[model samples]
Target chain A: MIVLSSVSKWYPNGARPALIDVSVEIGAGEFVFLVGPSGSGKSTLLRLLLREERATSGQVVVAGRDVARIADRRVPQLRRIVGCVFQDFRLLPNRTVAANVAFALDVVGRPRHVVRSVVPEVLELVGLGEKADRYPDELSGGEQQRVAIARAFVGRPRVLLADEPTGNLDPATSIEIMSLLDAVHRAGTTVIMATHNASLVDAMRRRVLELGDGALIRDEADGRYDQTVPQPLSPSATLPPVVPPPLVMLPPAVPAPRGVPAPTALPARPAGQAPDAERSPWATPTRSGPVG
Target chain B: MGDTDAQWPGRLMRPGPLASLLWTGLRRNLAMTGAVIVTVTICLAMLGAGLLLRAQVHTIDGFLLDQIEVVVDLSDGITPAERSALEAEMRRDPLIAGVRYETKKQVYERFRRDFRGSPDVVAGVGPEDLPAALRLTLADPRASRDIAVTYTGLDGVEAVRDQRALLDPLYRFLDAFTVGAFTLAAVQALASFALIYTMIRISAHARRRETAIMKLVGASNATIRAPFVLESAVAGLAGGLLVAGVLVAAKVFLVDGKFARQTMFPLFGWAAVWESAVVVLAAGVLAAAVMASIALRRHLRV
Candidate 1:
């Protein structure tokens, strides 16, 4: 679980604060979409959760520990339980997919047998099992992101924070990457992804936390991309539907193995449930309570 | 997690991704690594040679000191009683190992025999022209100063000279050379350190992305730094070993073989050579490790 209570962050020598009194609570196994325009504090929030930056005047508690209060030596232990995926797909260009996946386990001192077994299993889960011998440059953009996701999930972190994982991918490839994240989420890993992709947020219909001017603007249980100005969900609006595999068919997403979120999808929304114009862009003040 | 933690030390020691990272880094930057090794080896060799030279010079200084003596020339007007008294005073002092008296006739005969090749000069010299002298061997060469001061203004003494006065300039020259060698070695060592620092800094900069990825994946600072540290230490150790080989080769070919006909102390004894080699190796590794660490702390965030 992650909790941010009135977190405000200001960079040194900066004219404006990056995040202003932002507070939110995200439960385990729930995939959260962090949507905002550039400089709107999307990345800053994720960085705070990762303990990359301490909150200026508030508490950031992750996995039951106050991140800012923890000693630096315990950072590795904290990070081990939190996986991060970046927009650039930061895989070692020189290493093969298998080695790249194995690196995550190796640094934490995993044995040869465990690394050997876990690497291929995770690779196969990400659909890169056959391409394990290929280098990062040799793979497609989608495939490289797969390798990254494989690396992040190989350690079986309780929380996965993805910052613009699809920023560099095309529409089709972005869909594929989103599906992979969805698959990882279904396996019970709490995923908090930051992106400018309005359509994916609209399509996923997951929990959406919107930020504007570094403050919490909206939070919805089953949110959509309409909070900001509406945009097309994808390049091809009328593209044919693709049925992703069920969660059982994918690898287990063990949500802490402590039974946090219910291991069941709330079901995908039926098409044409509500027209875009009929839904209010901003939450009604009466219904939109103050953030915790 | 428990299993991994328990086996961390063993896994760390074993060759894995870190070892491969070290190998790849070295191989890709072979020229830089080679430069570091060569520079460090030359520095260490210079330092070793400087130390050996100092040791040899000290041995020669000791030998020369052992042969030193004080010469006291007696006045022509001195009475036989005064001469006997001066000789007795010299013999009574504990600092004097032995004293020998040479009369005027005896001195003249000895000088004629020594200068027989120069017959004209020897023929011009008379028995009165040569003064009688007392040759005094010191029990301790360092006591020459006290003996010279005591006997200089004595009634029978015309002049008192210690042999050390003549050898002082040569000793001073050798001492200066030793200091110069060490200074040059220190400068070369600084150059070697600069090369190592630059090498590590460049490599760390080049690998910044990889290091960032490692950090994101929960790799500790030690984990990220281990490969770089090991790489430098390995290079330093290789350089140190090369220095040892060069010294041994020099000992075998130059000192023992080429200078075999001369009666001199060995340039550096085997025990001293090995001891110096060990010290050099340890210093090289330590210096490299420290340089790598400092560079990493400044350049690499992880």
Candidate 2:
């Protein structure tokens, strides 16, 4: 399980904050999607989960430990437990597919006997078992990404974070890659994906969290992909338009930390409905009767 | 990881990252390796020459000292019995290796033999004013000063002389030649070390990418450098052995030539060359080992 409270992040020497006043939680075996536009703090949120950046305030707990307080030397252990697949697909170009995966095992000083068995099994898991002897240049982009994912999941990390795993693949190949992530998630790995693909998110029917201007604006259960200018919601609709999955509902609608919109205490919206367009984009989905 | 250097001697011998990386560098740069082998071979050849010359000079000095004779002329008041007794006392001294009596007549005959074919100016009269002498050999040449000091004023002696002074100038020249050879060998050895280090450094620079990758992959620095150090060391030792063999063979075949019998050139025998070769080869191996070990220390980073 991962937990964060009052986690605000900022880049070094940058005036604008990347993420402000974010408090959220993700339970074990939960698939959470962090969705935002190009500059929305999606990658920064993922980077926080990976401890690539420390919180400016408060604490971050990942896999039952306070990751924010851990030493830099022990960070690799955290990385070992939390598998990260980067966009660039960092694999040694000179090695074969098998060798590339074997490198991961080798870095942690796995025995040769163990490496012999684990390499082929993980390759098979990613459907690259037969292409083990081929070099990276011989494989297509999809295959190479599969190899990267295989490398990430070889040790079966507790949390899997894939950032843009299918940014360059075709639609079908993207579906295939998402299926692989789903398989890994089903095997009890908590998967957090940051992507712009709506069809994959809608088809999977997973929870989604949307960010705007580096703040948690709309978080919904069984959410839909709409070009919704986020406004207020009332008690009229039968099925409310669900926001993204697993949002720790927004706080007061004030200036939130990290440039996020502070959510005020408000009434919950109904399901399978449209987003209210009359209120400001930063307002909550519904307004309660009065202020406290 | 904290205190590896505090370990025992056996642990010290284990290949460190620096040595291992040097080993790889040595293997990758075969041209430099070939150059090292040739340079070491030349060095070993020069060392062997110096050794053989030193040994040959020592043996010739030994032969010359053996021929050096001490002359003791009796005073006017001394009798034949006193002279005989004095000779016996000198022979009984444990420091003497051997002593041979020579009358004035024998000295003249020996001089004629040494200076044969010299013209006597239209007459057959041979110059015969050579000294009466007792040829002496000491267990140690250093004791000659003591023997000369003790025997100078004894009875039955006109004059007791240690004539090794005549050979002093020749000895000094030989000493200079030996010193020059020793200096040359040392200087050349230093040059060889610098040459080998530069060669290994160039090799490392050429293949630095391979080493960096290995380091990132968690290979220890020792595993990377072992090949280069071993390669250069083997080449150096091989060169030493080769030069040693060549010198020994040359001594056996060339020194037995007819010109060696005509006399001025003091060619060394095979045994002399063999003994000297062993010493030279030892020196060469030591030099190579030092160069190999040092090259690794300076170059291997990963």
Candidate 3:
């Protein structure tokens, strides 16, 4: 669990604060989307959670520890329980896929037997079991991200913070990644993903916490991406309802096998066509309508 | 997780993985590693050689100084009773270690033997021409000047010569050489430290990605730095061993073989060489480890 009370972060010599008096609480096992544009303090918030940076004012607590006050030496211990994933997939290019994953466990001083068992198991869970021996350069972008995901989840961290994980991937591959993350969330890990992908936010309809100009402007359950903008109820409205096509259909809560690669090549869709809700992988039919 | 944390220290105690990591780091930077080892070897070898040379000079200085004596020459017309009285007085003096009276015949024979290589010089000297004298060895060679002045111009004395005065130039030269050797060794030690620091910096830069990933994965600072420090330590160990070998070879081939065979002065023995070698070995390893640790602190923050 995480609690931030009126956290305000100011970078030295910066013209404005990065996060302005923002306070929000994220509970365990809840999949939350942190929606924001560029320079919206999403990455800063994630770094604060990881204790990579301290809050200039106010308390930031993660897993029952005040992150701002934790000693530098104890940062590693805090990191062990909080996993991070990045857009660039910061994998060691020279290392094999399995080695990259095992590194997470190895650094924490896990026994060899545990590393030997846990690495391959996590790789398999990310659907990269067959490419365990390949290097990052030898894998596709999607596969490399899968390896990064495997590494993040290898420790079974209590909270997973993803900073634009799908920023560099194609749309279909991004769907596969989202489905994988959804599976992880179903396994009872708290997932806080920051992204600018409007369609993914709209399609998933999870709890959305939006940031704008370093301020927490929206906190909505099952929210849409552009919910902050008031809807114009007139016939002269310029923008149509932006319903993207369902690119791939994945089995609910199951990791796809290696043999069946996610449908990465999207089929062209007619403009203004509303996607079928039944076909969207992220749609939860039992959830209530979007609440702001 | 708690169980794993309990076992974390025990896992580090296992040498297999840590050793492999150290080996991998060294292998990855083979050129730098070789440079470090070679630098340490040459630096420590020079230091050991300098120490041994200093020891040898000390031994020779002590030997030559022990042989210093004040020679009091007797006048040709001095009486037999006067010579007997002068020898008895010198024998009773505490300043003199020993006194030996030499007759003109014995002095002439010694002169002939000393100048046998130059026969013309020996032919010019005769038994009657050589001065009969009392050679007084001083308890302390440094007291040679005072004792010589005390006996100078005394009755039945022709001249008093302090051998220490004649050997002063040789001692000064030896002392200068010792200082020069030590200074050169100190410079080489600085060079070795700089080389090690540079090597660690380059290796840390080369493996930045690995270290950064380790930090991200919650590796402790010790765990992140162990391999780098250990690589330098291994190089130091190798270099120290090579220095010891070079020292032993220098002692056997240079000191005992060439110098011992060529000179009559007492030289330092194997025990002194081993002592210097051990000191050099320890200093090399400790310096390398310390420099590498410092460089890592600056270059590898994690």
Candidate 4:
């Protein structure tokens, strides 16, 4: 289970907050869609859910632990419990599909015996059991996404959040991917996906939340993706923290070099001199020895 | 899954956690790792060669310092009895090794022999013009005071000059060069480390997509870094082993070989080259491992 209460996020340079006083809950075996338009904090919320971004204020609890209180060192453990499918799929192009799936186990120091049995099993679950030997580059988009999904579910993580997973897939391929996710949700995995695709979300009829300019604008039990018109409440009410100076750019200046003369002298003071003269060309400067 | 596939990679590679990391990492960066191994081997070979050459030079330097005799010059016309007494006195000094007298004629003969094949003007010098001298070898060069007190006022000598003055400076220069070789080797070793680090970083960055996936999948830090560090260390090992072999071969066929034996000063311990290579290998590999560890910290960030 994942829970957020009064969560707010503000970026260092952002004009407005990414998340503003948002609260939500996701339970086990539930298929939820975090639907929003562009710049609507869907990605930010996802990042916050993964604890990749910390909330400026409020609590984020996932899988029986307050993830907001987790130190950076212990974040990996939190990540292990919550498998994430990135929008870009982030497949390691260097590893074979089987090795990529096995990587999840390898990092936690699972023995080779467990890896050999598990890697193929997960690949089969993702429908790439036969293509385990292929590299990420050798696979198609849907195939690569499947590899990513396979990698995430290989550990049987309690929670899964996929960001824009079906955004790049065709209509037919999108349904196929959704079915796999639905299958995972049925098997007791709490799944949350953020996507702009309306047909897929409407077809699933799951719980949905809508965001606009970082605010939780709507919540519906069986919501369909729709274009929500913006209503600017008070654009100029908040004062700007710092005003920018007008630009009048100029070219950079170049500096000139100073010429220095070279110093020339023989190696050992030409072989004979007083006892307190320079001894060697490289010798340190102290009047204790002579060179001739 | 078959049992052999499960156990074979582990057994064949003889991998602990680190070895398994190394094996998997090498597989990932196979080309760069291969290149690093070759490069490290060559660099280590050069370092070993320089070290072995320097070792031989040190042995010869020691021998040279032991042999050059200090010449004591007293006022002319010493009697035979005084000379015998001086020899006996010097023999009693702890620093004195041996003493020999050179009469005017002996000096003339030695000069004639040394310059025998010189141009015509040098060959006609007479024995009467030569000065009588005493040749003294000391157990320690710094024990120059033995001659300072014993031969300074003795008859038939004018000046007592330390012969080591000429050769000591030469040895000092050689010593500096040997130190320079070590410094140069250290710098090159550092460069090799940087090269390995850069290779790992580039390879890691290029395959960062995979690494991110690996991280999300719950891979351990050691499992990810082991392969790259192993690849870097392999460079050092290759360098060490090659250098060791080169030194041993040079010793057998070059140093203790015919020309070296026939030379004015013979070099001892021809086997030291290969032995030294083992040390070089250890040092280089250790250095490479350190570099990889530091680089991995930055590159393997979750």
Highest-scoring model, DockQ:
1
DockQ of 2: 0.04
Between candidates 2 and 4, which one is better according to DockQ?
4
Instruction: Show the lowest summed lDDT stretch of 10 residues, model 1 chain B.
Output: B1-10
Which residue pairs clash within candidate 1? A187-A253, A188-A253, A199-A233
Query: Where does candidate 3 stray beyond 4 Å?
Result: A186-188, A202-205, A222-224, A228-292, B1-7, B10-14, B34-38, B61-166, B234-238
**Which candidate, 1 or 3, has the higher DockQ?**
1
Decreasing DockQ order of the candidates = 1, 3, 4, 2
Mind giving the per-residue lDDT tens digits that candidate 4 earns over B219-269?
A: 545555666777777767776777677777777787767657586765757
The 10 consecutive residues of candidate 4 chain B with the worst lDDT sum are B1-10
In terms of lDDT, the poorest run of 10 residues in model 2 chain B is B1-10
Candidate 2's residue-wise lDDT over B43-86, tens digit each?
Answer: 77877777776777777667655665555555646677986787
For residues B1-302, write the lDDT of model 1, one tens digit per residue.
Answer: 11122224432423666788888889877899999998888887877777666766666656655677898989989999999899998899999999988888888888899899999999898889988999898887777889999999999799998887776776687678878878887888889878878888778766666677677777777888888888889888988899888877877887777865575433446766777678778878888888788777876665
lDDT of each: 0.77, 0.67, 0.77, 0.68
Ranking by TM-score: 1, 3, 4, 2
Candidate 1 residue B208 C-alpha distance from true site, Å: 1.2
**Model 2 over residues A1-292: C-alpha lDDT tens digits?**
7776666666654445567666666777778777879777787888787776788776788877898887754555566667777555656676689977776655444556766898899899989989999998999888888888887777567788988888878899889889989988988888888888888887886766677766666555555444344443211122224523223334556664433355453222233333223221113434521211
Q: Each prediction's interface RMSD?
A: 10.0, 16.8, 10.2, 15.4
